[model samples]
Target: MELVVARIGRAHGIKGEVTVEVRTDEPEVRLAPGAVLATDPPGTGPLTIETGRVHSGRLLLRFSGVADRSAAEALRNTLLIAEVDPQETPEDPEEYYDHQLIDLDVVTRDGTEVGRITEISHLPYQDLLVVARPGGGEVLIPFVHEIVPEIDLAEQRAVIDPPPGLLEEPPGVDGADGADGAEDGRR
Candidate 1:
């Protein structure tokens, strides 16, 4: 299985060191020195990690043959993918790889069908599950234990306990009833 481990950011310095937005939890194993990663643009890599360091809380990587800032800048926004065994699982049972969550059936605590997991959005603060709703739309479900209480891999389902408005469309703001938040045509 191929998993996206990181995305190349801006060039860190004059050297071929580029900052990366780390995606995978096992960066020490996946993005360590001497690891070869495939790039999203396909032809841009199989870039080998010549060196890695943490500068200003960001991961800086220098790829083999990429010797200058321009070379590093060229890699910006490129995704770094790593190959892994399909049977590999995380050390912690509570944690799950993005690949494992994708395609899992989504249901409410009451067993109402909500959608299917299409994507996992990894933000700096939280991860969001992109679900394709049965009625032909998408909903972003925050992948928190409070909202998503259970992930049954053997059953291939995610049991969510969403708040009142979570699974539905957002209501009017400022205590109004409509989208514009106005019962009369005043404000």
Candidate 2:
């Protein structure tokens, strides 16, 4: 699987070097020279790091053959991706990549299947899982330990025990008072 590592920023100086805003917390390990990067915007092509170093808390990267300001400027906002081996060990047991969480089934403590995780939204306080129900609705479940009690990645399922009234919508709020809302426990 390919993991996003950084986004290309403005060109640094007149050379083909560009400033990269590292997305991973372990920037030092990911932004090393000779690392292969797949550039998005599709046709901009892939880049092989000729040289890479941290500068002003961001990454300064020089890609092989990209030799001028124009070349670097064209790549602004392109996402940098690295092909990650699935067998590679995770940093921690609890630490899961966003891609791994996607499509996992979500269930209740009573063995009731609630929905399947379709997407994950990163927030300042906590990550939110977007669960798509079979009945054509979505549940916004917070990724808190209190709510999501268990996750079996091998089974591709998660168990949740949401607080009371969390799934209830206030009266007269459009379609918020649906059965899926009750399952999501989003107030």
Candidate 3:
């Protein structure tokens, strides 16, 4: 279950180079030369980084066997992943992957079961947790320490104390009206 760290972008130059949108926090360390990577939706063979260097901002990478612009272009938009051991543990208690947060039970400080985390949005300022309820519409809670007081990934639960009016339904909006109401609830 290796996590995705980068995605191959468009070809960089006339050479075998291609632009890679690095996803790791430590891009320089992870996207080094000679790094073995696996592609998804899964290619015929593994890709080896023959050379990798920062250009402008994105990583310029040259993979072994990909020696032409057309060859490099073929890998565009392909996700690159490294083999990560599942047994490896996180260094910090607060640090958790987005996949780990999905399906976690969301509750209020007063022990009110609000919903379950259906999706996570990575915004410019902060990440947002989309909680899906049984009857009520999705509650968009910002992923901050104040709003999300606690996260027990092992238990698959989160304790949230959202700001006032954060979870209230919009005025004149009802679930039974049509898809518009459901669509408006998302905004």
* Every model's TM-score: 0.88, 0.72, 0.74
Look at candidate 3 and tell me the lDDT of residue 151.
Answer: 96
Q: Residue 11 of model 1: what lDDT?
A: 94
Off by over 4 Å in 1: 172-187
Clashes of each: 0, 2, 0
After best superposition, candidate 1 residue 9: deviation in angstroms? 1.6
Q: Candidate 1, residues 40-67: lDDT per residue as tens digits? A: 9998999999999998899999999999
TM-score-sorted candidate list, best first: 1, 3, 2
lDDT value, candidate 3, whole model: 0.82
- Kindly report which residue stretches of model 2 are placed more than 4 angstroms away from their true locations once superposed: 17-26, 50-60, 169-187
Clashing pairs in 3: none
The TM-score obtained by model 3 is: 0.74
Q: What is the lDDT of residue 175 in candidate 2?
A: 58
C-alpha local distance difference test of each model: 0.92, 0.81, 0.82
Q: In model 3, how many backbone clashes occur?
A: 0
Error of 1 at 57 (Å): 2.2
Worst 10 residues of 3 by lDDT: 174-183
